[model samples]
Target chain A: MRGPLSKRLFLWTLVWAVVLTLSAPTFVIIGASLTAGEMLQFPPEGLSFKWYRQLWQLDDFKHALTRTFYVSLICTLLSLPVGTLAAIAMVRYRFRFQGTLQVYLLLPFTIPLVVSGLSMMLFFGDIRVLGQLWPVGVGLCAINIPFMIWSVSASVNALDPELENAAANCGAPPVQAFLTVTVPAVMPGIITGALLMFILAFNEFLVSLFLTDSRTVTLPVQIYNSIRSVITPDLAAVSVVFILIAVVTIGLLDRLVGLEIFLRSK
Target chain B: MNRTLNRKPIAWTLLDAVEISASTVWPFRGRAAVARAFLLPAVLVVGLLLVGLGYIIEYSFHELDITTYRLKDEYSIINYHTVLERPVYLRVLGRTVLASLIVTFLTITLALPYAYVLVRTASAAMRKFLLFALFLPFFIGQVVRAYGWLIILGREGLINAAVTSLGLPTLDLIYTYPAVLFGLIQYMLPFAVLLLIPAIAAIGEDMELASEGLGAHWVATFRYVVLPLAKPGLVGASVVVFTLTMTDFAMPEILGGGTNDFIASAIYDSFFQISNPGLGAALSVILIAVGSLLVMGFFLAAGPGTLGFRSRV
Candidate 1:
């Protein structure tokens, strides 16, 4: 009782208290989503999955969910190669403008997503040659590539260059060496980057709001519309679904790639 | 080349093999060359988009044509003038900046002990639990998290229920400025922790041990040693949290309950609700200026820890 155990215990309690307080809303929402009552309430009135059933019956929810998945998938597919190449270059090369290039690649991180969406709409809304989601996809791809670069580049940077060199020295061609050796070394970061991109694109709303029409509404926008207008506890259920999906995906990711690497934006 | 091509008059496979072998034997197999070749397409695309942002800047200087719903032919600074003249824009901007700053401060204050404990604790199970807690909300995205707040902080929400059940007067908690700020703080707390963990982890145990040995209290040791060492991360998180909260549209819209419009909301209203693209562009330009200036100020004040770019390469 007299040692540092007390101090450590106090700190541990304080930390958990903060964590629990911050996370309470999410838990409450999940519980409220399952309530038998129509209105949202915590320690819910009764247990029921009525909202989930109702959410399943909505056409708008279905369309938005499908659109969100499809668009996020497309965004991930387009950005992975582009972002990976850029990440590899940023990591592998040293040139006169290396620093400048790094900064340039990362500038999108600072721009408000709302501003990005508005600007893209201003520039491309006039084209009328393409659909709304296509431009939204492009803008998302743009914002996401830099993040992709940052994430994938970390894995690339962590690699020991000699492993690739050894493959090359064994008479493997550059492409063969890269594919066989470098790819394995950097696969984790690439996968993590791709997953992050998918999640981000799937969840992105501000940019989607600016760019997507009612015809092209994504899930989050759909959710927002429901919240602003009329919707059932189905939304609360959807929110729970979002939380569950995020928790599971991130839990798997925490095991695979380690969420710690996100902080090492070196 | 001539010998390989001699039998390949119409043989594409032979030509492909010959081309591949040529590349295999080519000189100057350098990383820079490969990187340059690979970086070309992405750089071009992203750069062109940046140029598109430049076009928006140009549009901000023009008047909107209500007839055609486009920027007018003649350019003017009248959009900028209107922005400056309207106190609402400045007020919203100020509110955004203030709320962002408040959130940043609260996040750091709340995150510091958590990060310190996570880093210092020898127990793996505890660390994993803390990490799990941190990543769950981070993965949920801003919109869902804000909605979570909606259910909990609503007029007849849980807190109010708890209050009224206790014979205490219920307070107007949701849909106020503080409510939006409260949601922003929660939304940003994870990011702040993620940034701070790295910095705190970098601080060696010896420094703290040494400080304690030298007759310093824990707070004093933290003030002198830990805080100084953790500056890079704090500044980095502050910039990120600030910029994010300032440009955020989702939190304010969902949690603000239609009255507490931040800059991003203002921009959205200008473009869509008001249908003044020029005014929207102007607001955007100003927002960018505000964000960029804040970033630049922090970078100059704190040195190159803004993004904490590694000079390793």
Candidate 2:
């Protein structure tokens, strides 16, 4: 049942304030990007796509865009299978020190991002692969794989052990049974994990900042460099691009796995 | 068997071999060894970072030689001394801790009702809208959102323009301590809400209804029934928000205008600008220590799963 009118009013005001605070920045960026005037401003002097067109002209942004996709895709690809396997093991078996191992897996996520970035920088520098792109992708993969594992584990945990045992009793081999029965059951979790990992790698800033050189700069780092150098409508234009990606990702996630389940997995 | 052999001869032979191997290995089929085999890749990946953390701990003990870009032969606690003794470092640490406390409190306070509505509201459209508002900023990431604030609060930005048009003075809002905290709270609100959703969802509507039916005022019900039930969520959200804000690099770096640096910013300057890996490593080590201690303290108080790890049933 709904609350009394006064109580409902209070909640409505609080939620609206929160919703506005959460969403206002994207609106401001979108508004600023459409400015005909040169400087970045909200309540645009004249609505135009000049900044968006300007983004198209900039080679640095284009290169950073592709680099970001490349890194995020690589991270997702590497993390999905490994994370799914780990989740299967964690859910489908009972083993020694499993609890300790679970916490060990979460350590990469719990450690301060800056600390992980610094440690990675030092290690990469020592090994002399600091300037390359793949290490950055691998680093992203390592920290974010836990997300994939958790997502898939939720699905794995829901499956009944009896199903697999039944398949075995029917004379289907374990691998065949797993491929036929278990894979379809856990596909939702695998997709959610892959999408979440990709988005994370896309939005990752601190670690990429510490790890990336000019040759390996991702979109976020490139935007950071631009912010430090200048304030212009082009940044607002690119920010709109970021907002669009977020919207699309959210839409896809909601359609695929239902947003409530996605929230629960967190 | 004859029909299967006739259909695909080479494929059958391979399947037969695989089945034979599986049966032989099936003695204790769902065994620890099989689990280990599945876990090996993830373990190695986690190991890679653990080893890096080990290096960070080692690097914290040495001093950087400026001219040659080398660590000193003898290890010392001199870097830690620098972090402890320097007023600048101490100020940054103080500010970081204070800001994290404030941000955590504010984010959780705001997230609770928002999460409640998101979960409890009867309208499907409203739930979808709330989730959209939440995830949009979430997906936009911290860096871009911080930049959005620059447009809203910068000297010639939106708020200033509105004030000027209204014939009032535009206050200097950006590049201050408050601005950094404002951005941090915005960034952290989504995370807290996401974490708190399941916690709040676990508190079934029936419980609230039961409390209300017993003639408790809404406030009393919230105080006794809701808060008591959702204590773990509040604690978990608080811990996550505090640790994340404590090590936050983007908000202060973007909104602080270089004057208001957090510990993460200081670490960055030491490594990239000052060319002092030893100092950066030391700062990171301290950050790690404080974060772990706080999380450990929460675990002791709240038990395991405060960070939302669901143990097996």
Q: Which candidate's DockQ is highest?
A: 2
DockQ of 1: 0.49
Model 2 chain B weakest lDDT span, ten residues long: B304-313
TM, every model: 0.91, 0.94
lDDT of 1 at A153: 76
Scored by TM-score, the top model is: 2
Where does model 1 exceed 4 Å of error? A1-10, A129-132, A260-266, B1-30, B65-70, B306-313
Give the per-residue lDDT digits (tens) of candidate 1, residues B1-313: 6786577555455545665886876655766777787788678657646866876788889898878887788989999999999999999999999998898888888888787877877777777888888878877778888877877777777888888888999878888998898888888888888777777877888988898899887767878998998887788788888888889888888889778999888888987788887888899889988899988888889865525334233
lDDT of 1 by residue, A1-266 (tens): 11156566766787988798678878877777888987665557789888888889989888888888888888888888888888777777777788777777777777777777766665676666235566677778887787687667778878888988898789776766766788788888888888888888888888788678889998888788888865357788888867877887787787888765654523
Candidate 2 residue spans exceeding 4 A from truth: A263-266, B1-29, B66-69, B306-308
Q: Please, what are the lDDT tens digits per residue for candidate 2 over residues A1-266?
A: 39788778888899999999998889888888889998776577898888888899999889999998988988898898789889898888888998899889888868889888888887899999998888888899988888889788888877787998898899978777777788888888898898889898999998998889888899999889889978998898898888889888998899998777744522
Error of 1 at B239 (Å): 1.0
* Candidates in order: C-alpha RMSD to true structure: 4.8, 2.6
Whole-model Cα lDDT of every candidate shown, in order: 0.79, 0.86
